[model samples]
Target chain A: MKKNFKLVIEYDGTNYAGWQRQNNAITVQKILEEVLEKLTGRNINVIGCSRTDSGVHARGFICNFVTETTIPPSKIKYAINNLLPNDIVILDSSEVPINFHSRYNCIKKTYTYTILNREEPAAINRNYVYHFKRPLDIDLMKKGSEFLIGTHEFDSFRKIGSSVKTTTRTIYSIDIEKQEYYIKFNITGNGFLYNMVRIIVGTLLDVGVGKMTPESVKEILLAKDRSKAGMSLPAQGLCLEKIYY
Target chain B: MKKNFKLVIEYDGTNYAGWQRQNNAITVQKILEEVLEKLTGRNINVIGCSRTDSGVHARGFICNFVTETTIPPSKIKYAINNLLPNDIVILDSSEVPINFHSRYNCIKKTYTYTILNREEPAAINRNYVYHFKRPLDIDLMKKGSEFLIGTHEFDSFRKIGSSVKTTTRTIYSIDIEKQEYYIKFNITGNGFLYNMVRIIVGTLLDVGVGKMTPESVKEILLAKDRSKAGMSLPAQGLCLEKIYY
Candidate 1:
């Protein structure tokens, strides 16, 4: 009998090509599928809830797969973690309804972007943060972020070559916070377009650093032109923080 | 006129040979001296407060040097950090008296050792923390640490080939705390012998696991033999946290 299981994963995506499986490079999905094959002794395809970008970290990612192995649900996470590499951790696993789909059942998603705004760049967290040597105006960034909140068409923040049929997406909220030398931008949305989170963060950073005025964010969103927005931020600073279903 | 200056440095020592200047390999001191030459147009020697081993990180390392550069002490840190690599940062700098010596005038030092106490090894902090897969008894580790606190002859914890003339060192405190899956051991002392902090942490970890009894720690100290102590922990887990003058 085949059993369907839901898996929650965490990974430092620095070495991964991305979450999607490809023949040329290593990916989180490929590794998960391979590990599942080894555990079940059968070829399987694992479907991820999100296709996180290369070099982007994830604290709570979800995936689903069907297996014929006799191993119980509780022991699957423990068993998989033992064989997985240090960068990839199977945080939790459980049996789900056979028809449950990790992607289609998702209600909301949250992403966080970290910026190290200090004179000296970060020494230890360089890979997890973007080192920007400037004092950012958090208040201005917050004011500019307010323009991005609420449901709207986010075509300006979407990548040029994205395959999505629609450019409209609803941003639920954007929270800007400053802790010591780190600036964190937590953004929640119904769905994000290709490179939407990074583009939004980049646009907000431009407003914080005086490159662009806070009022410019509104015009950029209205224009619906990708060139009106700032350059997309690096993937290292972006993390897939959480997913709700 | 030459001026003496003190610098508080932070570095990810994963790639460094050590804090000391050596003819072979890349050391922190060698890179600082080279950067100083570029900044001041004069060859200079930097005297560090402690000689940290290779792969040991530092958040607040102290060092002193004399130079004839006309750059103000307040701006020196900013200038030097620009030339230094991303992994090394000069956190602070100040002008000190001509006779000020970072190594001689230091009154206390603090170091922190981090252990990822979980089934899976860390991917994000792979260079900064040690991964130990076992159900560590924190209470037992804490109890064992009590015997090593206060002033004691730490000959058992000292590494072999150490040229220290005296084996006696006074430990001010040992703070052991477990947060989630991370265990941090912060130790403060008047002075530490070679590999003293690492060896102490290793012994406590052995106690945390069922490998050694907590009460056996006292007997190991009394034995005054290096062979009686546990193996020294990896250097990557150790960090020179702070130096108090």
Candidate 2:
């Protein structure tokens, strides 16, 4: 019997080329599809809810695929985990309705960018955070993030060559918190463009370091030019934290 | 003019063979010595305070070296960091007395072992923690750890192949703290055996999982036999946290 399965995944994307499969690079989608195909003895295409960039980690990424194997949903998770590498883990798996679509049904997505705000580099968490040696003003960063909330045209934050038809997007909230040497930025929205979270975090970091003023972020948004905003930071610091469906 | 210098070092240890220099494998000491030899016009031997096993991390491993260069000690930290790999960092460097020795002058050392006691495998901290899937009873572990406090002839916890004349050591304190999924064991002592911290943690984990009783640890200590205690845990979870001069 063919059944639609929903899987929530966690991966430390340091070694992967991203979620999309490529001919020359290893990707999460390629490995997952190969594992499914080997188990079910049929070619399969695993559909991911979002296309994460290279080196972007995920704690709760959602995906869907149809399989004809008689293995139970709970057992499939265990089987796949045993075959997959240590960096990728299946957090949960369940059978979904035949009409269910992971991408279309995703109501909201949340991303988190972690920055190690310290003079010394982090030894253990080097792959998980972006180390910024300079001091950052948390109050200024928070004030700058307020301009990112609510609906707006996020053209300035998106990558210049992105192929999205519309640059407008709705943001639900933005939260910034500090714990000792770590500064985390959590942003929730209906959708994100290419490198949107990283660019926004980069701009906010500029504000925190006194390179840019808080009110100038509004003008950058109004300008709708990618060059007016801060450059996109490294993908290793960004993570797909959670998704609501 | 020759000058003695002290360096505080930090390393991830995931890809290292150990702190001591080896013939076929890469070690922390070898890298430091090579970097110093290149910087100065002389062959250097960086003497570390401790000889950590393969895969053991360090946040504050102390070492010393003598050089004839006129480079300021403060400038060496930045220069070495720029030349060294990302996994190793020189946290601080300073001039020390010519008679000072890192091993003999070290009065106290603290080591920390981190355990991810959870059902799921650790994704982000896979290289820094030991993943124990079974449920661990903290009270039982703590009770077992009490037997290891204070001065004791720790022959049972020492590695079988080590060549120490006397197996006596003094432990100043042992602190156990749990934060969410992580359980950290910090042990401060005048000196540690070849595998003392790993063996003690392994024994405590055995007690936590009902493989052994808390009272058995006392008997194991009294026996002074290496076979009486649990096996030494992996070196990846152990870290040299700090040192007192």
**RMSD to the hidden true structure, all candidates:** 3.8, 2.1
Q: Estimate the TM-score of every prediction.
A: 0.83, 0.94
In the range A128-201, model 2's lDDT, one tens digit per residue, is 99999999999999999899899999999999888988988999998999998899999999999899999999
For model 1, the superposed segments whose C-alpha errors exceed 4 Å read A22-24, A31-43, A67-85, A93-95, A137-152, A160-179, A206-231, B34-43, B70-83, B135-149, B206-231
Residue-level lDDT of model 1, residues B168-212, one tens digit each, is 999999999898888999999999999999999999989999799
What lDDT does each candidate get? 0.91, 0.92
| Model 1 pairs in collision | none
